[model samples]
Target: MDLILRCLIFSLLHQSLYSKPYNIDGLLENGTGAIESLAKPLQDISTKDYSWAKGNQTCSQLLKDCKEFLDLLPSSSSWMLKPVLALGFLQVGCLTEQEPFFLDLIKDKNARTLFNIMAEQTNNSIHPTTTNSHKSQPDIQKHDLLRFNLESLSIDAQSISHHMHCSEIQQEQQDVLLKGSILRSHSSLQHAMDHCDRVGPVCAGVTSDTLGQFKSVARNGGYIIPHVGSKLWLHHCTAGLLRRRSTDPECHSEKELRIHNVMQWIPVVSGYYNAGSAIYYATQGCTAQAEDRAIDASIDLGYDALFTATGGVSGAVSAGVGMAVKPPLRDGVKSAINYFKAQWSG
Candidate 1:
């Protein structure tokens, strides 16, 4: 009788997973589950918009604000926080890397064409009315401009990182270092390319090439290539963690330290995606490209790491209860299979 009852309950639950009006009441009982639940509403909003919305009251800000809401509740195990935190960190990391790249792409006419297509589609989805249609047009354009602004900022950002080597800085500079005559020569090509490419990979390639050209433009235009030169100088000054004179001539040690401090918070800013956990487990929200990417990547990475680190926490916990348990070797093999499937599907 007990066997039959257990089978029936499991079947009902499994069926409910695919049924309509999926509920979160079950998942919300757990911390990680609850955090995931909360992230659902704003999963589709752009990180740039979310950062801006903290001031502009956009959906992104609404999502970021979930941190405070989570804090208000009772504390939970670090296990729950790991996935949440991981998702957050990954989001910020991707954004940090891609933001500047996107800016460079915008400088190319080929890349701009791609950006315009993506930007317009993203904008139209947000505000769906007559006046909003016109007003939101600029919003899309602004998204493209953000890439440029971020790239310039990235140059300054790198300058302040004292840990980077001169060789690294020079390599980075080469990527963005635009020289005289070259900028003028490439400018038209970039604009033309930005408009020309429509396909994803071709468009992406155009954007990357265009940014390289812009680097030359910025460098030759006498722009201050911040961290590249600054970091190299800092390394020259403070060889070790030795506290040097505050008056060290070659480096802005204090400024670099401050910038690094700010960079540390990028993960926190990105953690808003964890709300997708609730959406996924609860079936409450629609899956989006960004949100789904955030979840699947973390799940794929986190589950494997956790299984290894905890020596299979679930199996260990199940051992005492006499549940049929897969050995670590078998479990690992199964996990590997699932990881590839999830990665490819996502």
Candidate 2:
């Protein structure tokens, strides 16, 4: 071996020289002084960002640590430990192309070292009847390293999922607020329809029935409300068109009747009759049933109100993030659910 390669081998053997089944813990049974000692130099070297000059130094140090650790292991330990070792070397190799001379220490040896071990472990684990627990010899160090790599990947995936979820909720909130504003505007029109007298026919272009059409428009916009605790105002052409009834002042009936403009019913009815243009298109369908429309409108409005409120809370957390973060927090919750489906299958 070259002088550089020899030093690296010595560093690895320093950790395993004391044990046979290549017991990592048994080697450190009294204390973890040896592994720490090996890791410290590498850690110090790693702190410097890898570049052509610094990168070479760090790679050399890391290679020394990895090789010495590998050479000290018994033949049997290498069989089980190779895959994880290979993966670690793969990570190091990735680090190298980015740094080139930076990985000088283990540049040549890293992959070969890991691949050889991985091939050995693959051979040992392939027997159809082999039981994991019943394996001839257990190599804890290799098992531990493999677990570490898997855990690192898992953590990254989970972080992405969380960020995506937060973004979805914020979007849902904005949608709800937008829909609610539309509903409130519609409510004001409904108020006008109830209190204003008719200028012409019941379905006159700008008459009371115009409010009914607004309800239908709201539905097409994705608002859906449940049946619970719904409130709506009903409007209909009643039979008592001309008769005026005397109200007892003590009963305070005038206040209740004030919405109808009892004094000017004749003029109000005439305005609906002669209006030059229609305010809204008449639904050829039985469209005058304002109460029903109100109920449906109210339902849609409620849906929008609730949706935005809840969605807003969700969206603010994840807004402006990637689409990955937005959907689950709002209407895209179904998509988020699909992600879980894949996870569950795995």
Candidate 3:
């Protein structure tokens, strides 16, 4: 028994000493290879006037391949694979029609480094230097000297945001809905600003302005309004107003009324309309200045007045009627809104 134990210990020690350090390099190389393979196809789709069907098919395939590559990666090295995963998702988002899954990725440090690398690569590809033509590069050059910064990352993110078929308003709405806290809404906004700092000023300005508007709405009693359905409905309405205000600060109340009508029926459809409107006015670009002015105007006029002018009375009556018939729903709405108010104020 002693002899057998000694042999087992010796064998285990030898294996431990000789085993490979996690092959991060190999994993990164494979990831880059996957990215490069999809890049050309993505480039073609962007530059060419292809039909939506054709482009969507190509995008779907790329997404599949990306998923396959990710699935094959060793589960133990998932932390190391975040950047690669971020890059793959970004590429797919640039080509696909749906909203991109990039918000969480943008929050990751490793993913940001990968974004910087891609941006640098893109910059070099766009403007190649003539002096480096004579050098013979080694197969495995060290990128330890490569500096990753926010400037390139911001540019890359902005470019991706533009291609993803959603407006800044829609993006901001999604950001709030996903990450915003009904309670601790202030902290949520702060977290968003922290994220924006990593992403750069373009995002910071927009995110700040949008969240500021949300705060303004909360401060002004917009959130506690009875019969508004839910905070989500209120958020959707605010986004529509903000998007319209991004262009015409003095946009007619008729549009606002239409939105209120839609919300009264199918609150979700209003969200879709707002998203579509955002795409339609995507070129207008929701600047911080525009948003600030809009907020000021909305506040000066008062949200209650705006809602009242845009058919709030009828909607309130309808909600009252519904509440009268369904005591549970009425209680639920009261409890929910009260809880929301407590969180908002707290």
Best model number under lDDT: 3
Tell me the tens digit of each residue's lDDT in model 1 across 257-323.
3322222233222111232222221111111221222332222222222211112122111112111
What lDDT score belongs to each candidate, Candidate 1 first?
0.26, 0.23, 0.27
Deviation from native of the Cα of residue 134 in model 2, angstroms:
14
lDDT of 2 by residue, 216-296 (tens): 111112212212233222121222222111222322223222311211111111111111000010111111221122112
Alpha-carbon runs more than 4 Å astray in model 3: 1-57, 75-85, 88-100, 104-107, 120-126, 131-346
| TM-score computed on alpha carbons, candidate 1 | 0.17
lDDT, ranked from best to worst: 3, 1, 2
The C-alpha stretches of model 2 lying farther than 4 A from their native spots are: 1-22, 31-346
Q: What's model 2's lDDT at 247? A: 27
Candidate 1 segments exceeding 4 Å error: 1-159, 166-214, 217-346
Model 3 lDDT, residue 127, Cα: 19
Cα lDDT tens digits for candidate 3, 146-252: 00001111113234323322222212222111112222223454454444334332231222233343221211111122222122111111112223333355332
Query: Who is ahead in lDDT, 1 or 3?
Result: 3
Q: What is the TM-score of each candidate against the true structure?
A: 0.17, 0.15, 0.20
Ranking by TM-score: 3, 1, 2
